[model samples]
Target chain A: MDIQKVTVAGGGVLGSQIALQSAYKGFDVTIWLRSEGSIERAKPKLERLRGIYKSTLEALKTDPSAWCRGLTDSADVPAEKIDELIARVDAAADSIKLTCSYDEAFGEADLVIEAIAEVLSEKEAFYAEACPHMAERAIVCTNSSTLLPSAIVGYTDRPGKFLALHFANNIWKNNTAEVMGQPATSASAYQAVVAFARAIGMIPLELKKEQPGYLLNSMLVPFLNAAEALLANDVADVETIDKAWMLGTGAPLGPFRILDIVGLSTAYNIVAASPDAANPDTTAGKIAAKLKSYIDAGKTGVNAGEGFYKYR
Target chain B: MDIQKVTVAGGGVLGSQIALQSAYKGFDVTIWLRSEGSIERAKPKLERLRGIYKSTLEALKTDPSAWCRGLTDSADVPAEKIDELIARVDAAADSIKLTCSYDEAFGEADLVIEAIAEVLSEKEAFYAEACPHMAERAIVCTNSSTLLPSAIVGYTDRPGKFLALHFANNIWKNNTAEVMGQPATSASAYQAVVAFARAIGMIPLELKKEQPGYLLNSMLVPFLNAAEALLANDVADVETIDKAWMLGTGAPLGPFRILDIVGLSTAYNIVAASPDAANPDTTAGKIAAKLKSYIDAGKTGVNAGEGFYKYR
Candidate 1:
């Protein structure tokens, strides 16, 4: 119940957002990276996001430095920037530490969030490394959008302490999150996770039972399934489908615009995660099939300049 | 195509909104009612809505009297009000007429709009009765959210001129409309409908083909389907679900609130028209079953002062 040090395993977009938001809430965060390159690539994005977070804090008339817990770049960020990152982390948290070794990661963390590649094996291996070293009461949460909580916790020794915690992007602005608790998860652990989410200004919906993608994606996947088919069949043009629903439903963006934001490659994974029965006859398979082609062709949305639709 | 007179069949909430909006667009429209009581019941509501429309016009800095084409009350509204209604209608359109007979309803009309009951038989009957009286180049459009476009137009003499012209509610402020063309509908017919929609200050989405509920409802039904099921199973309180989605997705209201606004009776009709397999096994069946009980017990929402949730 004495939640203190927290670690985010992986430096992906979601991992970074979770880390940033958690740190903003005054939790000392160490972002563990699998490789030096990920740490380096994630640094600029993290700094840029922090800058945006600063402006957000200003708008809300809150002081960002007041909650500056700490950030540990671990294996990825440039060694030269480590001191500055650690200084910010220290300002946010009472203490901060960084190390390239997995042992150092488990040694100092009270809550470890695994947010690596969504591959089952990759995440399973990461969980195995932390199970023995993490404190008995330390909560371990995943930022997995498509994986079941049972599947991820199955590899851990203290399975009762592991759960899934999803955060909406640009964590500082969007305040929604989903927390999935497995059958073996302790009530205290779920409450701790919820407490941590609340401490960070997140409105978390706790699932009574864990399902793949939990609730948000569970409700949304079927919609995307039909939309992709609609696009493939040329039933309606992209802009029309996008603008129609955007205006009609008051969704911030049309489905395709959202698909672009989530990345075509990521969208393919979500679509593939959905059972075929959810969409049997439609050729929305083109969404995934074409995504792999587009990614292979080096065309990923705003990041790569092209996906389902072009972005500047 | 020479656009002249129009007949709007039905005198319900949606039908009235459509009639009011169409009248505001400078059309001499005769709204056909099902029974004498309906016309009587609609009189005060129509006057109140006209007052709302008048304020809406003032808010937009326009003349209300000059914009109204007509306010014809069917059998329920007395023939004594005919001259006053005709005068209001004539201020906006070239002329206006009121009648109680279905046999003479579509005579000399350039366009016939079916906004009657969602019941297939009821709509089919209207199509059969009205089609013969429509002018040669006249367009037939339905403000149907549930029924298939082809099925309704199938009973018409000129299916090639049939389309679904859907307008959002609160039409005085919201100007989005969906134009769905049936399989047999001619290109010119679709174009003419689109032209009419545009002339009325609506931003039209010309769907390539007719889909059930057209574009907006096709995307929306599933969301409501999921939300309704969640409410039925007590997965979450109705208010929370409404708040979660409305605040989360930025919808004006959650599914339940929308259902209330749309009327439980109408919501039940829409659900019945939807493919049942698309909804949650437990929750999807609840709305219709609940309504059947409610209607039989005379407890429909707003009209009955109670539904899934009560309204003041």
Candidate 2:
């Protein structure tokens, strides 16, 4: 199926990016917000993204490394053609429509990307409200980082078309879209979503089964947890762990540095939820305690200016 | 304690690198081999490393990105100074002394790096033979990847001076040296080892306690294990898993590629050793079985020309 009209549910960080990137790719895009306040908040985010996209495209003209895969075809675009692409960025930015009504957003959408809150009940209610308005052929994909599609597929009207299309942050640069489908999801719908991911200039990673955390977080969380365990167990300090990973694997950042970017609260909640964290003496419990101390002290993460390491 | 005369026990892959890198930094270096055959085998490896170092230095002269942090001061070296650096590489390669006698290698040595077989009995036997000849002031460090310093400190004469200084592969570029100390190890001795690691152009990651797998593998192994579990559980294929990680994290290589480089046998051994592998229904057991099938087909890793992916 040719996906032209795309409706993105919610106008948050990931949702705004999804809507903007879809429009940037020449898709007729609309962002479905919950309220006027959400629309007001989302407009500035879209504007900021527009400025970022313009500057990034400008950088690509002179520097080859500035080429964002999702924004352009390749790094070797002729200098003259770059101007056209930059114009397209502005055109795409201005083209996106915003609506608070479920009928207006999903009535004719070829694809409805649910990028709302991670709360289960919130997603269920949003799906139920939006389901009646969506087109019969429209495929719905949840852009959930942690929750599984199978758990929520029952709530959606078109279970056969419901799956997942998870994206990494900064979609234009780190252009990976993980397409996962539940057992009930139809093969045609899965293929269509994979093709749609490719149309948006993403490397689509297809998962055969529903895996929690998908592919990226499945690997990342365990790695971060191990590093946190080391710190809580007093095997090494923060800098030592970061330096070891960076110098050893040639990775740009270490676990703690990544945690700083990912936010300590996120790490704290994940650890606190683990069964092992119930006991204070366990490694998970100790990690939770450690993160709580940091969070309580206002050293939440890089966003707060400090976490494992101080950031200016 | 100032270290000058350095002895590297064994002439294996990492042992040769440690000896060469130390010699390159102008230390008086000796490599002790177990037999005449071992000396003959090590000569070619040193010759190969010399070629690599020369070409790498030559590359650094023209391309700033080619500057190996472990080999040179910085990428901004004057073009005229490169010839001198190249000359030093040749000189360092030619200066290394090789011997089979434990007394000849350990006598008057300021530091001894045990880089022999990973087997416990072999390491214990080596330390027993070399301890009598080692100088009273000499600090003994095991370059063991998996074994803890505390586990082998009892074999050495100087328990207070014993520690672990593990180096990553391709030490010229990946120049991380993890320094871990046991409770019996003196603070001064640990500090000396850290300084010595820096003197050899290594970033010393100091671990306060002896952690199995040190800093790198402690985090790396768990990350790889999670990826393996994903594949074993049939959630995703090898390439899908690799692509998700590489794109999502902006890492150069994915877990399977790293596993291929790390060798399937090593991964299999590590997995099979886990207590969970006793049950075939467990993820660890499935991963071990999958790795074993690949190993049985002679697809060991990149070295064997095939594993999860093929290399030219």
Interface Cα RMSD in Å, per prediction = 2.6, 1.0
The top-ranked prediction according to lDDT is 2
- Tens-place lDDT digits, model 1, residues B117-216: 8899888787777677667877889988777788787788887888888877766555677888888999998898888877666778878876766666
Q: For every candidate structure, what is the RMSD over all alpha carbons to the true structure, in angstroms?
A: 7.9, 2.3
Top-DockQ candidate index: 2
Model 2 whole-model lDDT (C-alpha atoms): 0.92
Instruction: State the displacement of the C-alpha of residue B286, model 2, in Å, after optimal TM-score superposition.
Output: 1.8
DockQ, model 1, C-alpha based? 0.32
- Write one digit per residue (lDDT tens) for candidate 2, span B1-312: 999999999999999999999999999999999999999999999999999988998998779999888998788998778888889989999999999998899997999999999999999899888899988999999999888988899899998999999998999998888999989999999999999999999988889897889988999999999999999999999999998887777778899999999999999999999999988899999999899999999999999999999985
In order, candidate lDDTs are 0.68, 0.92
Instruction: Please give the distance, in angstroms, between residue B172's alpha carbon in candidate 2 and its true position after superposition.
Output: 2.6
List residue ranges in candidate 1 displaced over 4 A: A33-49, A55-90, A93-96, A272-299, A306-310, B33-42, B58-96, B101-104, B229-252, B263-311
Clashes counted in candidate 1 amount to 16
